[model samples]
Target: MIELRDAAYDYGGGGLALRGLDLSLAPGSFHFLTGPSGAGKTTLLKLLYGELRPTGGAALLFGSDTRAMDRDGVSDARRRIGVVHQDCRFLDHLPVHDNVALPLRVAGGDVASRADDVAQLLGWVGLGARMHARPPELSGGERQRAALARALVMDPDVLIADEPTGNVDWDMSQRLLTLLAELNRMGKAVIVATHDLALIRAAKAQVAARVLRLSGGALSAAGADL
Candidate 1:
């Protein structure tokens, strides 16, 4: 679990990207983070995952203050959290299966022993047939799904997705949402940062999520209008 208590972050000359934020992500919790351009959603996500420690307040991951964590501490905490970045950062030279297996490999996991799990995860994301395709050969939706598969291959306790459905069509967006919802049902905490209101509404029928809005370097609960 992660908790931020009056967390604030400033990027030197970039001014304050986030400030006075308090958030607690417990087991089985689901949250949707929404905001406009330059609103610091990505910065907040980075803080949550321990990529950036808060400059003025506490940002804790798995019970330890991120500011106090060493590199190995950060890596250990990150291994428990899976993040699907906005750009779907994949190595074009690697096939989808290998790309999905990269995290396990980096974590010193037995890739050979988990081959079947990797295949099953790709299939779950609807990319079974495209497992051998390289990143450059995939469609936008396919790439997103593949990214999700990669994020999940580690079986992390939390999943954080940034604009996960931004490049896909409505149907594909729904498909991805359904997959996320299923994961939530299985007890993983889910945090999705998206600007898509319709997608948020659609998620209403599938899972219980607290919608949050970030603006002017602060965070607030979204109104019922969402």
Candidate 2:
């Protein structure tokens, strides 16, 4: 869960990208953050994942204030909160399974021992047969699903996805949302930052989801239209 109270982030000469943004994501909760191109949607996602610290007010990840957390504290909190970035980062030279297992390997877990889990996750995302493929070899949907698999490898408490379905086709977008909804059903707080109202509406039809709009440096509850 993430909580922000009057949180403002200023990028020096770039001026303030976000200001006075008040929001909270509770356990088992699902939210859709919608905004225009220049809005601070991605910035808000980074704040939730501890990539950016607020210049003013509070940004809490779990129960600790992010501004007060040391490197170790931030890293520890990240282990409990999984993130799927918009770009869908991956090591081009690594296979899908190894890429998905990177977090565990970094946390010093026995990656080899969890091979079954990794395979299960890949299959869950409909990528079992492609687990051995490199990032460049997969299709767009496969890449997104692979990223999701990587993000969920830690079995995180909170899942933050930034524009996950932005570049994919409609079918792939729905597939990705279904996966996210299933995770929410499994009790992970989910916040997806996207401008895709159609996908948001589709997700709403499948589960209880809240819509929040981030625009003009403020956050407010949006109607179902979002």
The RMSD of every model to the true structure, in order and in angstroms, is 0.9, 1.1
Cα lDDT tens digits for candidate 2, 57-142: 89999889999999999999999998888889899999999999999999999999999999999999999999999999999889
**Number of clashes in model 2?**
0
| lDDT string, candidate 1, 1-226, tens digits | 8999999999989675688999988889999999997899999999999999899899999999999999999998898899998899999999999999999998999999999999999998989999999999999999999999998988999999999999999999999999999999999999999999999999999999999999999999999999
Give residue 116's lDDT in candidate 1 (0 to 100). Answer: 93
Model 1 stretches astray by more than 4 angstroms: none
- Range of the 10 consecutive residues with the lowest summed lDDT in candidate 2: 217-226
lDDT of 2 at 134: 95
Candidate 2 runs further than 4 Å off: 14-16
User: What shift in Å separates residue 176 of candidate 1 from its native position after superposition?
Assistant: 0.5
